[model samples]
Target: MKRLFAVMLIILLAGSMVFAGGKKESGTIKIAVAGPHSGDLASYGLPTVKAAEIMVEKINAEGGLLGRQVELVIEDDVCKPEVATNTAAKIVGEGVVAVIGHICSGATKAAMGIYNDSKILAISPSATNPALTQSGDYPNFFRTIASDDAQARIEVDFALDTLGLTKIAVLHDKGDYGKGLAEFAQKFLEADSRAEVVLFEGVTPGAVDYTAVINKIKNSGADGIIFGGYHPEASKIVSQMKKRAMDIPFISDDGVKDNTFIKVAGDYAEGVYASGPMDTTTNPLTIQATKEHQEKYGEDPGAFYLNAYAALQAVFNAIEVAGSTDYDAVTNALRTSYVETTLGKIKFDSKGDAEGVGFSMYQVQNGVYVELK
Candidate 1:
């Protein structure tokens, strides 16, 4: 009787262990999506979060990977560096396979160390500071959009060759993304061509008043003005420029490519030229996805949505290729494989950065951003 009882106990214990292992294997794959869901730059960050959510939904509905549904855990970093670092740590603690976020360059830089130490991949959709990818320590970092250097070159060429402008003024908000692009533009314009920066200045972001800065640009004798910042301050400065009767042609980078700029600046946004990645609305898949997004959320997708969507696609593709949630496998797959996304085919180079991509120029016409041929 004792021998028979011992045999039954061993069998029961073995069966319970098998059940527990199966339950663990069937657990959901978690991906963290961090951005400024609330704050001054929420216009850019919220869309990124929404785009990631859309990608997760699509992936899950199409039969989730490895027979486990994917889940997105969102955290708001408020577009601040300190908050970004803490949010990244919290996401890592949650055991997510990867993170997609820190839309601003400064915030991304802040969270880089945390992500590096944790061995999780962080793919940003909108952070464009050239220095972010230039650093050798951030092996897990990736971006879908072109860098500021590429966009700056495009803008500089357009200003000098297309517009035939030789004298220009450059301004930035002193943030990593803003100042980095501005400095690049200044150097490229001055050294690469006859174009000169007649004035270089910095402005505090979220400032309520910019009349003095506008006046300074107006008096600098510059034929063109290039701004490196987001829509809020850009709109304010442009509005002040018009109010002060400074009619110099205004140009900017991708940071200003959103409807919020037009809404905030109103008609003052007219005639402004900006360059960024191609608009997703121009793509059929992106258009369809955006329509569904509006139907569900009751709002149009923002500028960074497509790029964010692409980043998420890349992450999932990496996971599918890796065949497991193991960090090293996913990271290896991400570095070696190419992902076809709405943005185009994405492949990371040795440094875990995207290959060279360019930006398109757009002009505000009749309150809409019309792509310039």
Candidate 2:
């Protein structure tokens, strides 16, 4: 009986040592990929999640961070604000090491408080609303993309100087990102005094038909349209404009830069311009990432998938710098460190915004998208 008792005690101690970190040492760590996985904005959401998957695969092949493979826990929030808040709570509950999303600005904003309180780190690939990082409230939130206001400035300059269109109309989806970016451009345009914004309007998102809004844009007699919304609606508006024979050029903020935009608008999308933060085709790292992405998924990467890959790069780099899983330590490391990513060198400032921000312009020509000098 004494011999049996000693053997049992030794087995229990070994098991305890393996699980001492509150989970089995299975050589795996669970992170989250949260966003609109099943809805219209899934075009925006899917890219980041898929990118995270690809990144994890690569890192695992090279012996993942600290010898633990990354396992993504996907949760779909449908890009709804309330759903996002709920999703954040669930992610935190799952004890995920970090999140790669809450893809839209509204979703990020709604979930920010929960993430902040829980000390759950979140890095969005596409949420560009300034408040997500500018408010200084979401210490745990970070993003790979530039703020909407930053993109708006470049877009406004192009509309006035390059397009030489003095009369412009601003349209938004009324969500946090759309409205904020639209108003940011309008505010700057208002200050310019050289350009005149003839109309400012908001369109209800997820609407099947926007002929009413389309007619409004046509009748506005504006020389250009600046849209602060996603691709689906922007495609409809531009397609309708084509049918109405309105040839004025319109520029879209990054939200509508996906290939789905061209697919939705078809031939009508020709000559329409969209702005993005980085061009994956040109960046050497992005070229490799894109090639790997295509080989794994059997399709070209989404418009912003590189940014998502960069987000993972940022998150993993921070974890490596921190050297531990403690929330505050990891959070502080992210806040203060400059991490190199596929997006080039990325460093977060005091407000948790990425430094060295800029935008790239893209236009649909000959039924394909290409970077505009």
Candidate 3:
């Protein structure tokens, strides 16, 4: 009896010690790839996942980063601000050295506070709200995309100077990204003496119908419309406009500049103009990246695919340059070191925007988006 009791006590002590030590670290370096992995915005986030997977596979094949195999921790936020805070907390809890997403502007804005507090470096491929970096609130935040201010200038200039439009309706989806962009569009149009903004409105996302707003746009006698929302809302509005014979030119921002929008809007998408990351088709790196994606996925890469690929390249390169994942060192290296990516050789500017990254106007023609010359 005494021998048995002593054996039981020893086993219990060993179990308690293991429990007290918490999760044991694996040999691989863990990086979180977070975004709206499911939901309507899944199309936007899944490409980043594939980009990271391909990049990591290439990295490991090249002997890995810092001689350690890299692992990914993917999380889904569904592009909601409320869900994003929780996702951010979960990523911090997972002991990741860095993060690659929180794709939407509102979600990215929500997650940055947590990342800043935890000292984790986060580089977003598509979060473009100016305040995310310009406000000086998130020192740990960086992105590979240009901000909306630049995009808005391109859009307004295209409308007034290129297309010769004088009166326009500016509309948004009532979300952080959509409304913020619409506000900038309104500001620029109001500043331009050649144009007049006939209407500025925000519509509820996922509504069954947008007839009310369509009526407003028609009644305003606007010769053109500028949309500040994603493809889902944009497609619905454009489809409705076409159905009503309101054939004025529809201009939109990067949010609407997606193949999914073209698919959803069908023939109505014809001649719709939107601004997106400038065409990099001529870049050799881009050609190689596209080829790799085609071979791996058996399909054309989706929206923001190259931008996401560039983000991973930038992050891993920064880690290599800094020699460690120290937050200050990695971020400093990001701002100082240039990495050749699908976007060409680029580095982060002081405000976290990617240098040499800018927007270009595109039009949906014959079932595909064609870059305007």
Candidate number with greatest lDDT = 3
Candidate 1, residues 1-373, lDDT tens digits: the string is 9999999999999998887556536888888888888978899898888887777788789988787898889999998998998998899877777888778899998998898898888898888877788767788888887776877788888899888898999999998888888888998987966788999999998777988887787788899988888998899888888888877788998899888998889999999999977655566666776786898799888868877887887888888999987788888888888877777676877665675335788999999888898
Which model scores highest in TM-score?
3
What is every candidate's alpha-carbon RMSD to the true fold? Answer: 8.0, 8.6, 9.1
| Model 3 lDDT, residue 129, Cα | 83
Q: What local lDDT score does residue 349 receive in model 1, on the 0 to 100 scale? A: 77
Clashing pairs in 1: none
Report the lDDT tens digits of candidate 3 across residue range 104-132: 99999999899889899899999978889
Cα-based lDDT for every prediction:
0.84, 0.84, 0.90
| Segments in model 3 whose C-alpha atoms lie over 4 Å from true places | 1-26, 154-276, 360-373
Output the lDDT of residue 243, model 3. 97
Clashing residue pairs, backbone N/CA/C < 3 A, model 2: none
Give TM-scores for every candidate, taking all chains together and pairing residue i with residue i. 0.63, 0.63, 0.64
Write candidate 2's Cα lDDT for 86-161 as tens digits.
8988998777888888898998899889978877888888888877887888888888888868888888988988
Q: Which regions of candidate 1 deviate over 4 angstroms?
A: 1-26, 155-182, 186-276, 356-358, 361-373
